[model samples]
Every structure is written in C-alpha cells, then in structure tokens.
Target chain A: MSVIIFADQFQGKVKKSALEAVQYGAQIAQQLGVPAVAVAVGEIDGAELSALGQYGATKVLHVADARLNEPEAGAVTKIVAEAVAKENGAVIVFAHNFAGRSIAPQLSARLKAGFVAGAIGLPDTSAGFVVKKNVFSGKAFANVSITTGKKIVSVMPNTFSLNPGGGSASVEAFAAGLGDADFKIKTVKVETVSGEVPLTEAEIVVSGGRGLKGPEHWGIVEDLAHALGAATACSRPVADSGWRPHHEHVGQTGFTVRPNLYIAIGISGAIQHLAGVNGSKTIVVINKDAEAPFFKAADYGIVGDAFEVVPKLTEAVKKYKGN
Target chain B: MKILVCISKTPDTTAKIAFTDNNTKFSEAGVQFIINPYDEWYALVRALELKEAQGATVHLITVGGADTEAVIRKALALGGDEAFRVNSDSQDSFFIASQIAEIAKQEQYDIIFTGKETIDYNGSSVGGMVAELLGLPFVSIASKLDVNGGTATLKREIEGGEEVVEVSLPLVLSAQKGMAEARIPNMRGIMAARTKPLKVVEPAAAETLTSIVSFELPPAKAGVKMIPADQVEELARLLHEEAKVI
Candidate 1:
C-alpha cells in the first residue's frame, strides 16, 4: 500500500501547491510506513516530471492527455482513481485547490475511501490517522480521524511549506483507462482576467476599499502592488459599486486568501472580509479612520488618508525594490 | 431536464462562532443558519435561470436532520420545485458523499449543482463524489455556465488566469460567485413553497473515512492600534522596519 498524490499541472508547469502536496504526501507516507507515489495529468514534460524528486515523489506517473488540460473535475477523478488502483495507494493526497476540491471527493467515491478536504497539517498517527482542518469559513478548526483503509484528503494551499532537496527521482509514462465519455466535461471558452496574480496563490496581496474614493485612484494601489509583486484585491462594496472586478473582491461572499502579507488600504475590516483573509500570516491596515475594525486584526495599522498615504507607500515600496 | 442542488445550513457570515457540549457540537443556541452564499449565487440562482429557460424541475437536497427542514423549505421558496433530506448529520466528507451518491443513484438527476464550498464545513466534495458515483461529469468553482444542446459551457479560474471548459449533460458543477446573483423569494414564491413537497429519506449506513474529534475557534484579535492620520508616510516606514513584510 502506497500513498498516491495527484500533483496538479497547468500547461505543463507544476504549481506551487502541487509541490506542497507532494511534500505533505511524502510526510504522510513516512508516517504510515508506505512509499509515496505521485501522478501528473495534463501536459507534463518527462524531464520536468523527473524533477518531482525535490518534493519526495519516489516515482512520477505522467499522463500526457490533452483532455486533462481543462478544468473538468470528473475526468481528473477517473484518471486519479485509475492511478490509485494501479499503485495500490491506500491514501491519496490532492492540494485543496479549485480543482482538487472538486475532484478528490469523486476519486474517493470511485475508490470507496474516506475523504477529508482542507487539511491544514500532517496526520497525528499516534492513534488513528487524524488530520486538522479549518472550518466555519476559517473561523474554527476541526480535528478528524479516519478509521478506513483508503483515505483521501485535499490539503489546503500554503498550509504546509514545500520541502526541497529530495533529489531527482525516476519518471514513468502511464496510460490510464479512459474514454471520450470519461471526458464528459467540455470546455467552450475560458474568459481570462488579465494582468493580476490569482489572489489565492499570491504570496503578498494589496487590497483597497471605498476609502480609496473612486476607480481612478486604483492606479496608486496597482502601482504599489506592482512594486511589491503582489496580487490586487478590493472590498465587496468596491466590487458591487463597479470600482473593481468581482474577481478582485475579498470577503466572505468573495475570494478567500491566505498570503504571507496582506496590506489593506482604506478598507474597514468587516467580519465577512476578515473571514476571507484572516488566514494571512501578517495583516497591515492603512485607513484614515481609527475606528475601522480591520485595525484590530492587523499586525500593523496606519490611520491616514489613503490618497496621501498610498502614494507615499508606493514610493517607498519602489525605493525598497530599487526600481 | 431534472436538476438537483445540494445546500447546507450554515451560520450567517456575521455570526459569532462558538462551541458547546464540551466544545463538541457547534452551538446553535444563538447563531442563525443561512443558506451558504455561494449556493445562493451558483446553485439556487442558476437553477432558477435553468428552470425559466428549459421548463425543468429543480429539487433541493441536504444531508442533515429535521432541523434543517426550514432551510430546505427556504430553497423551495427561493425557486426549487421540491426538497429532500437524507436525515443524518454526516460530518465526514466521505460519509456525506456516500449519502449524496446514494440519493443520486435513486433520483437519477441530469445535473447536480452545489456551492464551491459551504461556509460552515467548507467541504467542497459532495457534488464531485455524486458525479463520480453516478459516472457523470464534474466541473467545479465555475464562475460562468451556459447550457445548450446536452452540453455545458463553463469558465473556471485557476492560479494564473481562467480556463473555459465544455461538458455533456449528466454532470456536476460547484458554483462560485459571478455565475449569477442570488435572488430573494417574492411573496408569491414564498406562499407557493409552503405547499411544496418535501421528501425525507433514510441514509444508507456506511463506514466513515474521518470523524471530527473537536472544534476550536480561531484566536481572537487583541485590539486596535491607533496612529495619527497625518503620519501616513511613517506607516510606510514601520511596514518595512517593524512588520518586515515589505
């Protein structure tokens, strides 16, 4: 029995989450006294696939299928299930990403295994294989125990740090049993949101709210984000008011993110918005109003007019970057 | 077309989280349970749109006990044609997926929809498991969806940009925002929902993969710090020297 990890790929590039998933899967396998095997679907080059050794993948099962490039969860479920059966994986680990969240459960059902999503840490195998996860929209955490033979878990992104220095491993090509019907989900068109890093995956995030006055002022925020190499976000009201795209909204009703540093400008911290960003390692709130709730949760707060403060902040960031 | 939208009754976004029974069960003593907002946008609203366009029946399903009936009824009022309850609190995703799978097997739904993830448990698993169990297709976190001629068009987000996908009928999609705006039920819809049919079915007993041992609230924020409004530039200096975030 081995631990199988679905290392997600995008246009042949391995995502950071996939590397973290492998690192985690390797740890779990060590705890369970089993070998860790990884599989990558979609466009993956053999040479790049062999480099999975850095994350403790003993073997990489590369499935170069065009159908896997799209975001159809069912097709991935079948492919992952096939790999698990071939490798006799007692446990399967997937990054709790948009794709993993949808596909892990399906694979678990096909394997009749127990499943857990949003795992935060490694299992405590002192007793049963138990995993901890954030629940209640990241307001609370729950520890879970799995008593079944086969277990599936979707590890939360950025929860575990990726480990390097596992050295290069061997790669193998595999032909999993699948058909056109298995590729049931078809792609018609993918609407692209241009020139912004995905908030969920960004190491740093720069967000603004109505306090910025209008969409015209967005340039300053964007400039600061550019210098910081950070993603951009807006408050729900900002999105609702058409000041920013809905994809940039960060709140309970919007995108949840956990970055290494989250800088909020001219935004009051509402509980809903906090639910989405409370996971950030450090929070800095820059707002004119001292009564703003976001200040309480912030690791640092600057009470000032954003129009004045943001420009200065942008200059400082640019200076720091020596750009 | 027959569509099944699964929902979970969760605490409203503003509710103060607390636990009871030695920090075991979530305290419902004061918290208000609202329809997960993602479901309201992705599942319920989208279902209503489909119902309007295709003249199809939409059913609401949940895997909770009788207490969740009101929430289920609320879905009916919003737009669902009927409701079903699996009559068990399957906390584990594997167990809940099985219950949903069993229901899908019996109902044979053409399309299954759910929120990208619930606000409470945040387990984005059921729809995918149901799709797999039924041997149907699954697409998740779809921000855009269109149905035509037994095929579906969807726009899903990834780490960098978004990916557009197409799939045949008999599939599942976990909806995110931007799919559709959530609609509130009108008086007529509310009145009609009162008389709508609600079916309660027992769940198939199965061994669970995971069991919750305890629950803990996130550590609370200490308090707000104050800085003068004019010292905005100083804040920038502190961000680098103090926070070391820059």
Candidate 2:
C-alpha cells in the first residue's frame, strides 16, 4: 500500500544514507501513487522520526525495542518483514550497509519479492519498476525489472543525493508482535570502533597504499582526511604487506565501496582494486608515476610523490576548512 | 564435525558484461567463469581447515549445471570429502536459498558456510536467506572463527573495526578475508578426491522472484593526462580550474 523506507540510524542518530533512502522512497511513493512511510527499529526519538518528512517521508513507523538496537540481523529482519506485511507495502527501500545486506535478502524470501542490491539512481517507473544497478564489479550497469508482487532493493551507500523539502512526518508506534521465535541468533557483545568514520558510509574517502613508505608518513593522509571529514582506506597490497590493516583493503578481494569523493595517494590502480572503488563518484589520483593506471579512471590525477604532494594537499585542505 | 561449504561460480572480475536474447538472459559468451574469489578464500579455506584440524568430512555444494562441476571438483580436489550439485541454474537468491535450505533441513550439518558475496552480481544475499529458512544463527563477514565443543568464537569485521562474538553450535557464517589462506590441492589431495562421492539432486521448485533484463558496460573514459611532477602549484591550479573537483 506504500513505499517503505528503512532509515539507517547510527548511535541513535540518522545517517546520511538514511536520508537518501527516505528521499528515494518518497519519490518512488509519489510515482507509485502511494504514500511514503519510514520505518525505524531500536531506540529513536519520535520527534526525529517525525522530522524525516523534510527528507520526503510522509509518515514514520517506530519499533523502539532495545533488542533491535544491537547487531542481531534476524531480529531486525523479523520486525521489518512483519511491519511490511501489516502496512501492505509492495516496495521496500534500504541502505545497503551491513545490516541491510544481512537482512534484506531474508526479508525478500519471506515476502516472495524480487530483491536487488548495490542500486543507484531512481527506479524507471516508466517501465515496470526497473532499477539500475552496478554489475560486474562496477564495470557495467544492469536494468533489472521486478515483476514479483512485492520488491526489495538496497541502495548503495553514497550513491543517491538526498534533496529534502520543507515538511515534517507523522510518527506512530508499530508493533510487529515479534517474540523469541523471531530470533534465530543473538549478539552477546557489540564492539564499536570510534574516531574514524565508516568507509562504506563516508561521503569522502582518502586512501593510501604501499607508496606511503611507513606508518609515520600516514599523518599526511590522515590530516587531509580529517580536514575533508573523510574516511581512510588502503590497497590490498598495502594491507597484505602490513603497511595497513586488512580492513583498509579496498578491492575485489576486499571491501567494495561507493563514495562521493575518493582520493587515492601513491596507489597504482590495479584492475582488481578498481573493481571495488569504481563506484566512487569522483576519483582523484595522487602519485608520481605518470603511467599509473589509476589516472585513466580518475577525474583528477596528480603526478607527484605522495610524500611531497600529500603534505601540500593537507595544508591546502586545512586552509580550505579555515583552521 | 562435517562441514559443507557452498561455492558459486561466476564470471571473472574483468569480463565485459552484457545481456542477450531480448534482454532476458545474461550473455556469457567469451567470458571466463571462476570460483567466486570470496568462496575460494572464506568458505573453501575454512572447510579445509576444519577437515585438517578435526579430521571431519568436508563437502562442496553448488547449484548449477554441468559446467559448474569443474569448480566443484576443484574444491573437492582441494579438500572436500564429497560434492553435491543441485543440478539446475540458480534463479534468484530466494530460489537458491530455499533449495539449500531444503537440503540442510533433510540432513545434519555441524557447520554451513559460504563467501560473503559473489563479485559478478555482488549479491551479498542468499546466506542470510538460507539461515532464516533453516532457523539458524548466522554471523556475517567473520574474519576469524573457532569451534570448541558446542560453542563458536567468531571475530567478525564491522565497518570501522572488528567485533569478537560467541555463539552456539550448528551456526552459519559468511566468511570474509583473514579467515584462512586458500590452499592449492597437491597431487595426493587431487587423486583422493577423484574417487570421492558426488551426488546430484534436483531443486524442488522454479524461480518466481527476479529476472535479469539487460546489462551494459560502463561508459568509456578519456585518456589519462599527466601533470608535471615538480609543478605543485600548477597542479593545485589545475585541480581548481580544469578538474574543479578539489
């Protein structure tokens, strides 16, 4: 009966991806001749949920349960699935994060809906609910049609731009009436990493590779990233060689990302690495090698040593930030 | 402890993607298919490690036609105790997940695993679907896993960092990197695998969820332009003027 949006929350605050999802869901709801409603699991302020109308939501459904706040994918999926059935929603939009990826497919199965991931842009309502998604590791695009009765799609992080209008949402409490049977799994503990932004959810990202030489030289990249309010990442070779931690690896064998601005320092663009990062909106490459393959894929390329260029770039960023 | 790791065969990472035949089917002509790299690392390696440590049975399960058997055999040669081919092409994540769930429901498996996602479609789904259908606990992207008696200790990777979690036995996990280094099969492992049992089963139903319409390659890029290395000021000016991305 409506387009349902799962508004992603981080530490009880709505993330940028959630706003984008809300905007997307609202737009789709308008196209489908239905209302745009928002769904939130765990503890979120009713006022904030009501405020999501600025991002295009008309109404918000709140399932403020303490168990929903943790890393239990099953619990979230159950609540969302039951809510979707109750709301008579035929389409559900989500931000393709860890929780979304873990929960969406299962929900699709339960609802018998067509599911898609890594989606970008608006759905082609002109043609039977077709969606554009990246395939072949961001090297290609696909226009897939969902003919099933219901549909689910997880929009890739940082892919869609959120354009909010002046409006407020009506928040109402929703009860999926879930119990212990809904829980196939439980999280005993949750370990959160502070200080650094999540790479997948970051708007801007600055990445370094083995070319940085040592950990001491990381200050340059860190400084630039901090000034830009960006997350940091590294190449697989750098992670393998111990120049950076394995989580920093971004490639086919590592994490796939799609950030608005991706800056690469001292990293030669390998095809495998490009497969992971090709989804970035604007790529900036900083390296001394003119023949670096990364330059071909970059919107901007600088042929200079990262050691020299990074410091200068960081200084410029600091000046730009007015500090 | 018998471990069954499901592996999906997909197009290589660098292949040109397109659709053919009225935009209803994926065009795989001239494309190379490999065992999903994540499956090779996470699921395959973990199964081999369990086989080595506990001297248990390790089986390779895949849902595909005859062509996929090669990769399943490769997994068998590597360390699998047996192989099972679902004997049909996977339709959607639900169709595939339901088939796997059916098989799991009929049998007893101490541990079930898979790669986090396939690179070709990047559909990081299915595993969670299977887990839900079978009513099993699942940990996504576990970089480390240990099973002692009936409990499991998993080091799962979060966005910015990692988390150490513990769960009961007979759980499911989507293995990511740092789980175990993938191993190549030696002559002994290969020879012993040739005689191992391989059972092919038919899926119970057809796909009703999703259908691929068409695919297209990414837009072509202009040639790479080089700036003088010593002209740092010029580079800054160009970033502001020509690129306008700074």
Candidate 3:
C-alpha cells in the first residue's frame, strides 16, 4: 500500500499548498512505512513535477491532460482514483482548498472511504487514524477518528510548513481514460484577481473594519499591506457597506484565513470575526478603544486612532524594510 | 422544476462553546440554535427566488431528529413549499448525505442546493457526496447562480479570482455569501408556515464511518502586550525580533 497526494496546480504552476500536502502525506507514509506518491493532473511543467521530490514525494504520476486545467470534479476524481488503484493507495491526501473541498468528498463517496476535511494536524495512527480539525468556525477543536479501511484527508493549507530537501522524483505518465461524460461541468470564462496575493494563500494579511470610517480611508490599510507584502482583507461590515468587495471579507460568513501574521486594524473583534482569523499564528490588533474585544485575542495591541496610528505603522514597516 | 435545499441547524454565532460527555457531545444548554446562516441566507433564499422567478417548487430537507422541526418550520416560513425531516440524528457527513440522496433519488429533483458548509462542523462534504451518490454533477461554493431553460450558469470563487461555469439540469450546488440576500419571515409568512406540510421520513440504512473522539477549546491568549501610540515602531521591532514572523 502507498500514500497518494493530489498535487493541485493552477495554469500549469504548482501551488505552495500542494507542496505542503506532499510533505504532510510523506510524513503519514513514513508513519505507515509506505512510499508517498504525488499525482499531478492537467498541464504542469516537467520541472515542477520533479520538484515534488524535494517535498518528500518519491514518485510523480503526471496525467498530461489539457482538459484538467479547469478541473471538473468528476473528471479529476476519475483520474485520482485511477492513480490510487495503480499505486494500491491506502491513504489519499489533498490540500483543503477549492479543488480539495470540491473533489475530496466525491472521492470518498466513490471509494467508500472515511474522509476528513480541513484537518489541522497530522493523524495519530497509534490509536487508529485520529485527526484534529477546527470546528465551530475555529472556536473549538475536534479529534475525529476515521474507522474505514481506506482513508482520505484534506489538510488545511498553512497548517504544515514546507521543508524542501535534496531529492528528485521520477516522473511517469499515467493514462486516465476520461471522456465527454466526465466533463459535464464546463467553464465558460475565468476572471483571476491580478496583482494581489489571494488571502487564502497569503502568509501575512492586513485587515480593516468599520473603525476605518469610510472607503476613502482604505489607503492606510493598503499601505500597510503593501509594506508587509501581504494581502488586504476586511471585516464583514466594511464589505457590506461596499467599502470592499465581498471576496475580501474575512469572518464567520466569509473566508477563513490562517496566515502566519494577521493584523486587524480599526476593528472590534466580534465573536464572528474572531472565528475566521483566530487560527492565525500571531494576531496584532490596533484600535482606539481599549475594550474593543479584539485586544483580548491579540498578541499585541496599540490603542490609538487609526487615522494616525495606521499610517505610522505603515511608515514603521516601510522603514524597517529599508525602502 | 423541483429544487431541494438542504438545511442544518447551528448554534448562534455569539453562543458560548462548550462540550459534555467527555468532549464527545456539544453542550446545548443555554445555547440558541438557528438555521445555519449559509443555508438560510444563501441556499434557501436563492431557491425561493428561483421558485418565484421560474415557477419552480422549492422543497427543504434536513437529516436530524424530531427537535429539528422548529428549525424546519423557520425555513418553511422563509417560503419553502414543503420540507422533509429525515428521522435520524447522525452527524456523520456520509450517512447524512446518503439519507438526503435517497430522498432525492426517489423524488428526482432537478436541482439540489445546499450551503457551502455548515458553521458547526464546517465539513463542506454533504453536497458533493449527495451528488456523487445520485450520479449528478456538483458545483460547490457558488457565489452567484442564474438559470435559463434546462441550463444553469454559476460563478464560484477560485484561489485568486472567480470562474463562471455552466451545467445542465439535475445537478447540485453549494451556495456561499454572494449567492443571495438573507430574508426575514413576515408575520403572514409565519402564519402560513404553520399549515405547511413537514413530512418526517425514516432514514435509509447507512454506515457511519467516522466518530468524534473529543473536543477542546483553543488555548487562551496570553494577555495582549499594550504598546504606547508613540512607540508603534516597537511593534514592528517585536514582530521582527520576538515573533520572527517578518
């Protein structure tokens, strides 16, 4: 038996989350004493496929299908299932992103495997396959034990650090006989967010909220984000007021972000808002009100006017960067 | 067209989280339960809109015990034509999906709608598993959806941006924030909801493959290190030297 990792890519470029999944799968394989094999579908670079070895993949199964570029869940499931059968895979791993969220459950249903999504840590095989995951929107944690012969897990992105080592994987072509039936969902158009780091993949995030007052004052948030080379996010109220797009909203009803550093500016931390961001490695809150509730959850706090403190913080960051 | 919208009940966002029975069960005392916001605000509202726009029948379904009827009545008040409560309290995603899929297969719904994920478990698994069981195409995390004749178009968030996709009828979709606006039940709707049919059906045989061993709250934060406004630059120094994140 082997461990199979689905290495997801976007437009032929492998995502950093995919490498994190590879490392996670390799560790699981080590615990089980099995080889870890990563399966890459769609149009990806050969060099990128070989680099999977650095993240602990012993071999790479490349399904060079152009149609997979816009992954339809059904088609990708068929391909991943074929790879699993070929490798005699006992465990399947996916990065719990868009692709994994869309495909992993279908795969579990198809294979009748016990599946876990948004897993935050490694499985404890000593007592069956128990994995920990955030529940109640990160307010609590649940240790779930999968009691199936075959198991599937989707690791939350940024949960595991990527450690590249010295190695090269042997790439082999695998044929997945997919047809028109599997391509039921057709992509009509793609509009990608340009020139900005996506919040889910961002290591550092600078977020704003209602305390910023209006959309016109958003430059301070952007300035700090730019200085930190981080992505910009907002609380739900700011998005609801049209100060920012709904996609940039980070809260219980919006995106859940687990960045290395999260700076909440001009925001009072409501329970809903904290649910989405409490998983960040470090939290810094800046608010004029000392009892804003966000300060309680913050690692660092500066009670000051956003109008004055944010620009100064931006300047401080810029000065620290020597620009 | 007939649409089946899946509903789930979750604790209110502000409710204090606690566990009982050796951390295996959520403590419901003093907690107010509401229809999961994603379901009430997005999936069910969108289905109700489709019912008005295209003369479609919107049906609600939930996999829970008899106590969930109150939550189902609330959904019915929001304009669902009818609702079914599967008589099972299984929290297992696969088993829950199986029960729903069984009903959908017998009823032959042209559209299956669900929230992207329930706020309580945040699994995001049921919709896709239901679609797989019934051999239907599944589109997830759809922010926007429009239908024309037998074809449906949807907009969903990708890693960086959004993509527009098209699929034929008899499919499944999981709705997110941009799908629709939340609607509050009017007094008339509340009165009408009392007379609406809420059928409780027996659950199909399905195995629960996973079980929760325990639950734990996140560690409490060490008190915030308050810094003076003038020493804002020290925040940067601490982030760089102490936190080492920069």
Candidate 4:
C-alpha cells in the first residue's frame, strides 16, 4: 500500500499547495513504510511530472484529458478513487483548498474512508491515526481519530512546508474514465480574477475593511498590496456593501486564510473577521481607533488614518525592495 | 418544487468555545445557540426566495436531538414550511449524511441544500457525502443558484474565478455568500412559525468512522507592539528585516 496524493494544477502548472500536499503525503508514506505516488489530471508538462520526485514522490500518474481542464467534482472523485484503488492506497492526501474541498468527501464516501478536512498537522500513528484539525472557525482545535480501514486527509493550505530533494519520478499514463455523463454541469462562463495572486497561496495579504470608507478610496490598499506583492482581501462588510467583489472577502463567514504576513488596514477586526485570519504568522493592524479590538489580536498596531499611513507604508515597501 | 435544506445548530459566532470532560466534549453550560449563519443567511434564505417566487415548498432538517428543535423552529420562522429532527446525538458527518440520504430517498425531493460548512465543526463533508449516497450531482460553494423547469443554474466559487454551471434537477448544492441576504423573522412569520409542523424521526443505524479524541484552544497572541503612526518606514524595515515576510 502507498500514500496517494492529488497534485492539483491550473493551466498546466502545478500549484504550490499541491506541492505541500505531496511532501506531506511523502512523509506519511515514510511513517507507514511505503511509497508516495502523486496523481494529477489535465494537461501537465513532462518536466513538471518528473519534478514531483523533488517532493519525494516515487511515481507520478498523469491523465492528460482535456475534458478535465475544468474538472467536475464527481468526475475527479471517480478518477481519484480509481487511482487510490490502483495503488492500494492506505492513506489519501489532498490540499484542503477549493478542489480538495469539492472532491475529498465524495471520494471518502465512495471508498468508505474516514476523511479529516482542514487538518493542521500530520497524523499521529503511534497509538492510532489521530489528526489535528481546526474547528469553530479556528477558535478551537480537535484531535480526531480515524478508525476506518481507509483514511483520507485534506491538509490545510500553508500549514505544511514543501520539502524538495533530488530525484526523478517515473511517469505513467492512466485511464481516467471521463464519460460525457460526468460533464452534466455545463460551464456557461468563467470569470477569472486576473493579475493578482490567489489569497490562499499568497505569503502576505493586505486587507481592507469598512474603515476604507468607500470603493473609490481603494487605491491605497491596491498600491500597498502591489508594493508588497501580497494578495488583497476585504472584511465581510466591505464585500457585502459591494466595495469589493465577494471573492475578496476573508472572514469567518467568508474565506479563511493563513498567510505568513497579514496586514489589516482600516479593519476593526471583529471576531468574525479575525476568525479567518488569526492563523497568520504575523498580524499588523492599522486603524484610527486606538481601542479597536483588532489591536488586541495584532502583533503590531498603528493607530492612524489609513489614508495617511498606507501610502507611506507602500512607499517604504517599494524603497526597501529597491535596495 | 420541493426543496430540502439541512440546518445545523451552532453556538453563536461570538460565543466563547470551551471544552469539558478532559477536552473530550464541548461544554454547553450556558452557551446560546442559533441556526448556523451559512445555513441561515444563504441556504435557508435562498430556499425562501424560491418558495416565494415559484411556490416551492421548503422543508428543513437537522440531525440532532430534541434540544435542536428550538433552532429548527427559528428556521421555520424564516419561512421554512416544515422540519424534521433526525433524533441522534452523534456528530459524525457520515452518520448524519446517511440519515439525510435516507430521508431524501424516501421523499424524492427535487433539490437538497446546505451551508458550505458548519462553523462549529467546520467540516464540509456532509452534503457531498449525501449526494454520493443518493447518486446525485453536487454543486459546492455556490454563491448563486437559480432553477428554471428541469435545469439548475449555479455560479460557484473556484480557486481564482467563478464558474457558471448548469445541471439537471434533483441536485445538491452547498450555499455560500451572495446566494441570498439574511432574513429576519417578522412578527407575523414568528407567530406563524409557532404552528408549523416539526416532525421527529428516529435516525437510521449508521456507524461512525471517526471520533474526536480531544479538543484544545489555539495559543493566545502576544500583546501588540505599538508603532508610532508617523514611523511607517520603521514598520516596513521591521517587516523586511525581522519578520522576513515581505
């Protein structure tokens, strides 16, 4: 039996989170005295497939199917289950992102496996297969033990580091049954968020809240994000008000993120909003109110008007990068 | 059209989460509970909109004990026609999905709806598992959904974009934000909800594959360091030299 990981890709390039998943699965395979294999669907470069060995994958399975360019969760689930069965996989690993979330549980049910989603750490195999996961919107943690014969883990993004080593993974072609019935969900349109790093994979995130006042005053936030090479996020209220698109919202009721540096400007840091970002390694809060609740949770605080502070910070970041 | 919405009772978002019995159980001393926000704000509200627009009947279901009836009643006040309490104290997602699938199979509902994930457990496992068990298509994290005749149109959030997809009827959808606005129960709706039917059914026998061994709270943050408002450059230098994040 082996540890099987789903190395997700977009536009033929392997995603960073998927590399993390591969490394995590490789570690699990080491613990189980087995090999780690990665399965990927859609168009991927031959060099990229061989590079999987750098992440400890012994072999890579590719299904170069154009039908899966925009994968339906059901079809992907079938394909992954097939790969798992083919490998006699004891543990299935996935990066707990959009694709993982859409497909993991269905595969778990199909395989009668116990699935642990949003797992923050590797499983403890000493006693049993116990995994730690975030609960209550990161307010609390739970240690879950999987008693099933088959196990599935969807690791939270950014929780595990990608470990690269030297080797070449052998690639093999697999038949992913991409029947026309699986494409029952017809895609009418795709609205892409162009020219910006995805919030989930960004190392730094600069977020704005209602304190930014209105959509017209968003230039400073954009400028700061661009200067720092960080993704832009907004509190739920800002998204609800249409100051930013809904996809930009990061909070308990929205997207949860765990970047290395999270800068919140004009955000009062409601508990709900903090729920989404408290996982950040370093949190910086910028608000006019010295008594804002966000200051309590922030690693650093600047009590000033964002209009005055953000532009100055952006300039300083630009200057620092120049040197 | 008949729509089945799955609602779970969760502690208020502001409620302090605590564990008891050696971290093996969630403490429930005086915590106030409500319908999970994602279910209330998106799934239930959207179902209510469909009910009003197309004369659809919206039914709510919860996999919990009698204590959750109050939260189920609140969902009815927000315009659900009826509710079912699958009497079970188990918190396993598979067991809950099995119960929900059994109900869906018997009822022959055209659509199954639920929140993207429950905030309490934060496990987005149920809806997909239920759809798999019932052999139906599942649309996840849908921000917008509309049904016309036999086809359902969905706008779901993907990694870096929104995907517009269409599927036939009898599908399952996990609703997220932008699906519908949160609805407040008016006095009339609340009074009408008092008389709504809430049926309690025994759950089907299903085994749980996983169990929570213990719980722990996240470590508290160190007190904040106050940087002078005028010294923005210093903050940038610290970010680069100390934090090494930027």
Error of 3 at A89 (Å): 0.8
| Per-residue C-alpha lDDT of model 3 across residues B129-151, encoded as one tens digit per residue | 99999999999999999999999
Candidates in order have lDDT scores of: 0.82, 0.80, 0.92, 0.91
lDDT of 4 by residue, B202-236 (tens): 99988798999999999998789889999999999
lDDT of each residue in A99-167, candidate 4, tens digit only = 898889899888889999999989999889999999999888899999999999998998876768997
Error of 4 at A144 (Å): 0.9
DockQ of 4: 0.82
* The candidate that achieves the highest lDDT relative to the unseen native structure: 3
Question: What is the model-wide C-alpha lDDT for candidate 3?
Answer: 0.92
The best candidate in terms of TM-score: 3
* RMSD over all Cα atoms, model 4: 1.2
Tens digits of per-residue lDDT for model 1, B1-246: 998898888888999888999888888878888888888767889988988997888988888988888888889999899888988987776677778778778788878898988888887777777777677777888888888978888888777777788777778888987898878889998899899999999989865766788898878766545556666556666667776767
The residue-by-residue lDDT of candidate 3 on A186-246, one tens digit each, is 9999999788888898999999999999999999999899889899999999988889988
TM-score per model over all chains? 0.95, 0.94, 0.99, 0.98
- Sorting all predicted structures by DockQ, with the top scorer first, yields 3, 4, 1, 2
Q: Count the backbone clashes (under 3 Å) in each candidate.
A: 10, 1, 0, 0
lDDT of 1 by residue, A1-323 (tens): 89999888766778788888999998888877887899888887887787888888889887888777764576677778888888898889998887788788888777777777889888887988888888887888888777788888888887776669847768888887778766666666555565666777788899999999899989988988998889999999999888887788887878778888899998898899998889888888988788898888987788777878778777767766678
Q: Which ten residues in a row have the lowest lDDT in candidate 3 chain B?
A: B237-246
| CAPRI tier for the interface of model 2 | medium
> For every candidate structure, what is the RMSD over all alpha carbons to the true structure, in angstroms?
2.1, 2.2, 0.9, 1.2
Judged by DockQ cut-offs, the docking class of candidate 3 is: high
Q: After superposing candidate 3, which stretches have Cα over 4 Å from the reference?
A: none
Residue B74 shift from truth in candidate 1, angstroms: 1.5
